[model samples]
Target: MAEALADKNRYAHAPRNADWTIDQDWASYTPEEHDRWNRLFARQARVLPGRACDAFLAAKQKLELSRAGIPDFAELSERLARLTGWRVVPVAGLIPDDAFFDHLANRRFPAGAFIRPERELDYLSEPDVFHDVFGHVPLLADPVYAEFLEAYGKGGQRALRRGQLHNLARLYWYTVEFGLLATPAGLRIFGAGILSSPGESVFSLEDSSPNRIAFDLERIMRTKYIISDYQQTYFVVESFEQLLAECYQDFGALYDDLRAQPDIEAHALCAGDRVLTQGDQHYFRARGMAAE
Candidate 1:
């Protein structure tokens, strides 16, 4: 059953366009596909209120995401453009690193054109339209985050030229995908990956199993992250402005400094880390013991 399911979800080749883009064909989505999207959205919606950052929740309503069904890219683009000059573009699947950076640099978010299968709703290897559009798009409405993404995109192009894409990717993994915010109400989620996953939504904040360390640019850049599991350590920033300020500068020198340093394990804590929550790592240890 697992083998057959894997085969069904496998991609033989990249989708249509030369640039890896395709028309969203908003009308072509079948009822089943839309239903899958609704299920994913509804599950996240129920758990996100106090957990998700204020910005995400505000934008969700602004974009009318809570209304019904999958949103049309054209309509979403119009709303996003009006807010922050950002727009959503449809892609077949993952695009090349350079191409991905190029899109962000221009304020164009390249989203996968498909939705996850109903059977694989909880886990999928690659991000689908629901993940791309729903998890990420609303945040793009905020001006600070919008500018930060464009800067990260531009910075990514330079990283590729410098052979520092790996380091740069770590920054994105920790911040854009799995970052947390220290808000007035306490720690809140701004990262798309955490906000999109119902299970992680609770585990990230409530679970006593993962480290919640303060965000440090160099610390995050040198850290390794898990691809197939929840992050063992999540970096927390005080504000979006702070995040933007830290990332706006040229990383050329920092990248040079990083090349000499050994990479930090995903869950390792350094002496200078501002320990927000020193997790017991119960989940991680359990997984390890099971593997053994």
Candidate 2:
């Protein structure tokens, strides 16, 4: 039989062992672990100044993430609080949805406490400190994006009470994890998943194999996404304020409307879509992870 889910904590809860609590042994991280953080941080920083959303770059600068070693949570949180009301909380690994929601609702971002092992630089089965802190934290400094996150967390709780969390989580996945943005300069990345990964950074915009459709709030909630690999279809937002304003508008009614309608196919494009790049979907088809 499958193992039971991990225990729920003040940070998160999940029915499967996906929920994790923070128990960071700050001083115990090996030299190699700190090296990994430095390596990943430096590499991404070099690439992000131009590719990342302005808000993200700014937040990263404000937070003063270390290029020499893994950041101490206390130090990082202090910087974050001065810019936004957000604070970073350490976690052992994934947390229960409710616990995750509660943290976000309270403006506390739960970061996976552990860094990945030396061998798993390219990938890991779960989010590591790199993915959680590097991928997600910078955007938290953007006030508009920060508000959307808090709203998203509050929405998650309501969705859980309504037994519609699966659908709601999908919305978070597509927008927060794999989202893109449209700027006068062309397309750019704001999503944590794309922001952190070097391969996806190239694949998402420059590659000819993935679809880039304009952002639509309802459409995003209805669409499916690829979790374990690069996304095939990326929703594009015009601006940060647009995403927050559109998303924060009462989703209660939108949620009801979605339940009453059919879910959009994962790969299907609608007539209403504003096509930025109509990818061949070859990269995803050849390398996509099986749907979760």
Candidate 3:
């Protein structure tokens, strides 16, 4: 990580103060940054509708996102709060899990304040503003998904105290960041990380290289993940209601029980899985692990 990213000193929680105000250096967004947002936005808008879950597509439409430019946080927050009582807050990037949970518990989402440099377009190790706002924020407009995020935030704080933050984070990873869904249309992209990228949006749904299993909270928590590449397995939920209903159930016992089990393989599919696609592991196998 760069010094600018590692120095936690520059980082601050979004929804700065009780007024819920975010001071994004809107004018400071460079032409290249805006162009990146525009390019990403145009490409995704075209790819997402049919392949993305109804909630995701609906939320994206409700927000009126465009390829015109990067959105101002103020405008986005205003519109989102109206729809789901949730707001977007600007942050320096990758805060501790505690801070991340605190913001979400209060209906505030902390987005990275910076954009990726132009040279690293296809990928960047750390999240940039485009990934945070464009990738994640649109789905926050849906009431069910918004509520689920706030609940996860609250749940995270408790899990952190019990030394179960890892468990809670897996819940988030399997849902918020890299989750899948079985919609009336078929398997769809709901995870923002997949939703924002040109290549991933298509690959996650169309690729035969990754496993797509049904969402099982316990299974998700125990499942290990790959950090070096695209996911080897993606969990699919039936609906946002199914996801929220499952999470709202007390996880205390589940967490306690899971702590005793060995971590599941990243690509393993258990008997309970409502298997969507049994991936062939082509992507990861083709590229061996690389150094940071």
lDDT of 3 at 100: 84
Clashing pairs in 1: none
Whole-structure CA lDDT of model 3: 0.80
**Cα lDDT of model 2 overall?**
0.79
Per residue, candidate 3 scores C-alpha lDDT tens digits across 1-292 of 5574434213344345433334687787668778978887777778887887877777777887777787888888898889988888887667778888898999999987766766667787778777888789988988888889999999998998899888788888888888988866688888978876777788888988888988888999998877656888899998999999999866889988988988887877788888878888777677753211
Identify the leading candidate in terms of TM-score: 1
Q: Which portions of model 2 miss their true places by more than 4 Å?
A: 1-21, 287-292
Maximum-lDDT candidate: 1
Give lDDT per model, in order.
Answer: 0.88, 0.79, 0.80
Ranking 1 against 2 by lDDT, winner? 1
Against the correct fold, how does model 2 do in TM-score?
Answer: 0.89
Best-first order by TM-score: 1, 3, 2
The stretch of ten residues in a row with the least summed lDDT in candidate 2 is 1-10
Off by over 4 Å in 3: 1-22, 289-292
